[model samples]
Target: MFDLNNFNQESASLIQELQKHVGEITAIRRFFHQHPELSRQEFKTADKIAALLESWNIKVTRNIGGTGLVGVITKGLSSKMIGIRADMDALPIDEATHKDYASVNQGVMHACGHDGHMAMLLLAAKYLSLEATFDGSIVLIFQPDEEDDAGARRMIEDGLFDKFPVDCVFGMHNYPNAPIGQVMISHGPQMAGTIGLEITVTGLGCHAAHAYNGIDSILVAAHIVVGLQTIVARNLPAQDAGVITIASIHAGKANNVIPQSVEMIGTIRYFDPKTAAIMEEKVKSVAQGIAAAFGASADVRLKHGYIATVNHTEQADFCIKTAQKLLKPEAICLTKKPSMGAEDFAFMLAAKPGCYLFIGNGPGDGGCTLHNPAFDFNDANILVGGAFWTQLTLDYLA
Candidate 1:
C-alpha cells in the first residue's frame, strides 16, 4: 500500500480533507443521478452547478453554448490556468440499477458516470475556492451533450478557451473496467475518432410472388453490411486499429412485399485521419458497387462526430507525475491501451495542449460498465478523482 505520509505536506493535507468529505460528495453525486438530463438540455444541471460554484464564490458563467457553463477560480496574477471538464448530460438508456438514487427521468440515466464526474470537479471547485493556495487560475467546466459529441464543440464556438485564455486544459472520464481508484494515462491517441454513416440502398419494389421482376433492397443492404465488415479487415493495415460497425438496418415492413429501400446505419472508429478517410471512401464505394450490382442505388451520408482524443506528451507526463505524487505509482495505469471510443474532449486538446485521463469504476458486478442500463457511478472513486484534481491544480498553479 502506498503511504500518504511520504507526500509533501500540502498534498497530504488536501487528500486528508478530501477523504473527510466522501459522504458529502457522494450525496451530491446521488442528487445529480436522481435528476438526470439529456445532451444540450441540461438546464437544471447547469443551474445546479452554477449555484454550487456561486455558493463557493467561484465566478459562474451561464449558457455559453446550449446548457453548458463554466466556473472560474482564481487566486493570483499568475497567467497559468487549468481547465477541468465534467460532462453533465446523461445517456438515453433507462435506469436498471434499482438504487435508491436511481434516475427519476424516464429513459435517461447517468450510465456514463457524469454524475460522479460532476461531483468530483465540483468538489475540487468548492475546495479550491475555499482553500486554494495556488497563484494561477482554474476553470471548472460542467459540459453538456457529451453523448451527442456536440457539447465541447458548442462550448468552443461560444468562445470558451478564448474567453478564459488557458495555457492548458484537462478532462477526466470514468472507465468501468479498471480497478476503482486506478488512473489511466496515455500520451497519444487516447481515444478514437468517430464517424456516423447512413447508407440508403434503393431498389425497385414488387410483389413477393413476382420477386424476379424487381430489385431487392433488403438483399442489397445485407450485402452492404457484409461488404463493410471487410474495410476494417482488408483496407486498413494490421497496426492501424480501426472498426466499422453496422449497427442498424431498416427495410421492408410487410411479409408479402419487397421493400423499395433499406437504410443501413453504423459508425467508423479510427485514430488516423488518413485511415478514416480511406475507410469512409471504401464504405461509399463498396456500398454503391454492391447495390449497383444488385440493380439498386446506394446513397451514403457520413457525418464526422468526435475526433480522436490525442494527448500532448508534456501534459500527459505532467498529469501522471502529479497523480503519482498523491497515490501509489501502481495506482496509475500508464500502459492502459487507448480506447477506440471517441470523445469531444479531442476538440479542446486540438486547441490547447493538455491531457484527458480516466478514473476507474472497476468491473464485474452491478453498475460498473458505461452506458449500460444498470451502470451507476461508483461513489467511492470520488475521493481519488477529487484529490487528483485538487492536487494537480495546486501543483500546476504552483
Candidate 2:
C-alpha cells in the first residue's frame, strides 16, 4: 500500500502546478465546445488532440478505430501499464446557452462534458510527461463517437488491447447532480447496459371512414408499447431494475388515410445481464403478440449497445481511498446509485479489471443536463479532476 500522507502532499503540489495552466485548459475546453463534431466524424478534433499530444513528446497513434479514437502512450520504467480514457464526441444539439463560446456548428455541441474530459486528460498527460512521476507506462485514450457509436468497442476490435494491453483501465464522466469538486465511486454495476430497438408494424392501409376494413398498425404499436412495460413491472424480479422507453412513433401522415406501416424506436436499459436478456425476449414476444392480435405483422430489430459498466470491487475501494487522501474526506462519495446512462468504457472494463468513476461538474443552476443544448463543461473542476487522475496513476503504478 502507498503512504496516504505522502501521496496527499505530492498530489497537492501537483494540483497547484496544474492550476497554473487553468487558463489554457479552460481555453482548450471552450474551443472544443465551440467547434463540436459528431460521432465517427471527428476529423479536426482528432487532429487537434494529436497535435497537442505530439507537442508533449508523447507517442501518438491515429486512425485506430476510425477517424476518431486517438491513442497516446507515455513510456515509463515499470513494465506494467495502465490506461486512462476520455471521450471526444459531441451531440447533435444546437447551442441554447447563448454564451460567447457557444457551438459555432449549428447542431453540434459538447453538451455531455466530453470537452472537459479531454482537457483534463491532456493536462494529466502533460504533467506526467514533465514530472515522470508514475513508475509504469500510462496510455491516454481520446476516444470518439461515444454519443452514437461504440468507439471503445471499435478500438478494441481494431486491436486496442492487443497492441497496448494494460493491467487496469480507468474512465471518468462529469456528473451534474453531484456538487463541484467531488468524486463518486461505486462498487459493482455503475451504469446500465443499453439496447436500441426499432419495431415496425405492418398493416393494410385503408380510409379512416372504413374502420373494420383495415388493421390499424398504430393501435397495434400502442398495445405493444403498453404491454412491453409488463416485462419490467411484472416479469423482472423486484430487486432488479430495468426500463423500456419508446421515444419515437411514426405512423400516418394524414388524418383521413391509415398508414401501411408504423415504426417505433426506443431503448432498453438493465443492470443485470440476465435481466437484459429476459427483457429483450419479452419485448420481442410482446411485439409479435400485439401485432397478431391486431391482424398485423411485426418486425423488431435490436441493436446491441454498450454493456453495463461494473467496477471491480477492489479497484473501487482503492480509488475511493486514493480520492479521500487527495481531496477532502467529505468530497468522496462511495455509495452513489448506478445511472441508466450508457458508456462505451464498458468495453474496456469487459476486457480488464477496472473502474469507471464520476467527477462532479457542479450544479445545473444555469447549466443544463447532459445531452441538453444548454450544457457546458465546468472549468472549475479542472484542478480537482487533474489531481485525482495524477494521484490515481501514482497510487496504482507505485
Please, what is the TM-score per model? Answer: 0.94, 0.92
lDDT of 1 by residue, 1-398 (tens): 12344345546677777766777878889999999999988999898888888988989988887898998998889888889888899988989998999889999999889999999888787788887689989988888888885789889999998898888999999887787878889879999999999999999999988889999889889888999999888988899989999998888889999989998889999999999999999999999999989889999999988899999999999998897787776677888888898889999999899999998887847645888899988777787888889988988999
- State model 2's lDDT: 0.84
Top-scoring candidate (TM-score): 1
Against the unseen true structure, what C-alpha lDDT does each candidate score?
0.87, 0.84
lDDT of 2 by residue, 197-311 (tens): 9999998899988968999888888899899888899999899999999999999889999888999999999889899899999999989988998889999999878899899
lDDT of 1 at 250: 84
Error of 2 at 146 (Å): 0.7
Weakest 10 consecutive residues, lDDT, candidate 2? 1-10
In angstroms, give how far residue 207 of model 1 lies from its true place.
2.7
Candidate 2 lDDT for residue 83 = 88
